[model samples]
Target: MRQSLLALLAKEPAHGYELKQALEAIFGSAYPSPNIGQIYVTLGRLEKDGHVRSVGVEQSNRPNKKVYYITAAGLETLQAWAEEPTEGPRVRDEFFMKLVLAPMTGLSDRMALINRQRRHYLSLMRELGELAERTDPGDRVALLLIEGAMLHLQADLDWLERCQEELP
Candidate 1:
């Protein structure tokens, strides 16, 4: 979230609300709308870390709003972050833990667990498919994010099948 805000500041100086709006515009419904207070807290941390700086812009009838700008260090940090590759999918997933431990814990309901998760994945895929269809065709980024999520969910469903075949 820090890097994301910094990248926005790199484009232009903006107040917290503007930054929040920019994020929403970028990610659309896919990005959970960040709380205004969370934005302020991140901005405060960025300023304290010297990655960003804020100036108070006063209004005649309202309280001053702090507008944030990316400092040189912030720009460098953002660049580094952009270049870094994201981590791949996690191997030790929570569901896998539960699947392995449930028998020992006397659940012994692997089929039930697998069926429940399969239903969940199918439901999410349907939702994501709907979201992709509703998304603007021009917004390639948003479409790709949705596509990626749908693909991940499909992978999870496939893994569940493999588990069903291998496990008693």
Candidate 2:
């Protein structure tokens, strides 16, 4: 959230509401929108950290608004963040932890665990598929995000099947 706001401020100075609107416009409804309070809190933190500077903008009939602009340090941070590669997928995840620990914990029902996770993944895939169908064809970004989720779910289901085979 901090870096996103910094990037937006780098483009131009904006108040918290404007930044929030920009984020929603970019991500669409695919992501849960950040609350106004969250944006303000982030801005406050950024100001304290010297990543952003805020100035009071007075209006005749409305309350004074604090407009934020990104600093040079913020731009450097944003640039570094843009260049950094994201971490790869985790090999030892929550599901794997449960699968390995179940026997020692005396549950000893790996198949049940795998089946339950598989069902959950399939349900998510179905929901995402429906969303994809409802999404406008011209909105390529949303479509791509939905398709990517579906693909990940499919991979998860396949991994569950492998777990079932190997554990049994």
Candidate 3:
């Protein structure tokens, strides 16, 4: 959620509700989106630390909201976070968990599962490539991240193929 907040705040100042909507848009329908309460909590934390500020009021017929603008300090912190190296992306793969139990099931089942993952990864690579093509050339960081994703997926696919070939 921190990542989502950081990315949205980087673009422009937004109210908590606006940030929630933007996050849903980027994530699409695959996962459950963050709640408005969560968004407000994050904004509160940022504000308390002086990383964000309540810039102005956004009046509406329905509900009036306070919009937040990221401070210069916030930008610096975000930039530093973006540039920092991590121990790879933090994610949980159900497929990897399934693979760990594959030997107990059967070699054929394991091979089939690996092939399915390979196909899925290949499809993801194609989608990422298409997205890259549509993105502006000036977005070097985005481009580099996309390329890195493709390479990572390719490596996984290759390993799956090798495993399939070696197994009975």
Candidate 4:
């Protein structure tokens, strides 16, 4: 979130509301809208860290707004984040833990758990598929994001099958 804000500010100095709108425009419905308070808190932290500086802008009828600008340190941090590879998916996820520890925990229905998780993934895939279809064809970024999510869902379903096969 911090890095995302920095990148946005790098493009142009903007107030928190403007940043939120920009974020919604870019990510669309793929991500939840960030809370206004969360944005301000992140901005405060960025200011404390010297990654951003804010100035008050007065308006005739409205309270003064603080516009934030990215500093050199923020740009460097954003660049580094953009260049870094994200960590791979976790192998020992919470569901996996539940699957492995079910017997000791008196939850012996492992197949049921796997099937439930599979159903959840399938439902999400269906929703994403519908979203992709409704999205404009020219919006290549959104299409790519939807496709990537679908692929991940497919992989998850395959893993669930593997888990079922290995379970007693």
Candidate 5:
């Protein structure tokens, strides 16, 4: 989020509300929108870390707004972050932990858990499909994001099947 905000500021300075609106426009359907308070908190942290700076702009009828801008150091950080590879899939993730530990911990039947999770993923896939259909055909970025999420969910369902076979 820090890098994302920095990248936005690298384009142009914006007040917290503007930043929140921009992010919500981008990912609100696919992911949760950033809370206004969260945006301000992150901005505070970025300013404290010297990656960004803020200047208060006076308003005639409202409280002054602090607009944020990326510093030179922030631009360098954003550039380096852009070059960094995203982390790949993990081997021992939460579902894996449940598949292995749930029985021992008396949490629930493993098969029941798997069945429930499979249903959840399928439901999400259906929702994403609907989202894709509703999405503007020209918005390739949003379509690609939905497609990627669907693929990941498909992979997760496949992995659940493997767990059922091996653990049974």
Candidate 6:
């Protein structure tokens, strides 16, 4: 969460609401949605740690919002995080777990689930492609995110095809 918050601040100065929106847009329905509380907590931590600071306050009709901007130290932290070396490939695949466990179920049920997931992933990939194309050309970060999402979906599709061939 800290790394994610730092990266979001690096993109642009945003109020808590906008930051939450961006996170929801990126994560979709997979994870629990972030709330104002989560955003504020992250901001408070970042501010206390000197990675981010309150830039200004905006008075809205509803309430005043504190806007945050990333400091140079924050950017440096992000850079270091980005540069860190680690294990070759990290894999935490819920879908694969589902696939592995499907053999206990009826064949029709298993196939139906696979087909449904394939269609959903394909739809998501198409949406990601459209989003990448629609994003501002200068927004390379967003485009890269979309690209990664699309690639993952495509790989899933490939796996689904292979399963189709191997099964029945």
The per-model lDDT (C-alpha) reads 0.90, 0.88, 0.77, 0.90, 0.88, 0.79
TM-score of each: 0.89, 0.93, 0.53, 0.88, 0.84, 0.52
TM-score winner? 2
Q: Global CA lDDT of candidate 4, please?
A: 0.90
| RMSD (CA, Å), each prediction | 1.8, 1.5, 5.8, 1.9, 2.4, 6.4
Tell me the TM-score of model 2.
0.93
Two-way lDDT contest, 3 vs 4, winner: 4
| Model 2: lDDT of residue 36 | 94
Q: What is the lDDT of residue 155 in candidate 3?
A: 76
Question: What is the C-alpha lDDT profile of model 5 across 1-168, one tens digit per residue?
Answer: 888799889999999999988987776565677888998999999999999999999999999989898999999899999999988967548878888888998879899989999999899999999999999887777788899989888899998899999996
| Candidate 1 ranges beyond 4 A from true positions | none
Clashing pairs in 3: none
What candidate 6 gets wrong by more than 4 Å, as runs, is 4-36, 43-83, 86-92, 166-168
RMSD, model 1, all Cα superposed? 1.8
State the weakest 10-residue window (summed lDDT) of model 3.
23-32
Q: What is the lDDT of residue 67 in candidate 4?
A: 94
Q: How close is candidate 1 to the true structure, as a TM-score?
A: 0.89
RMSD of 3: 5.8
Estimate candidate 2's alpha-carbon lDDT, on a 0 to 1 scale. Answer: 0.88
Per candidate, the number of residue pairs that clash is 0, 0, 0, 0, 0, 0
Clashing pairs in 4: none
Model 6, residue 55: distance off in Å is 14
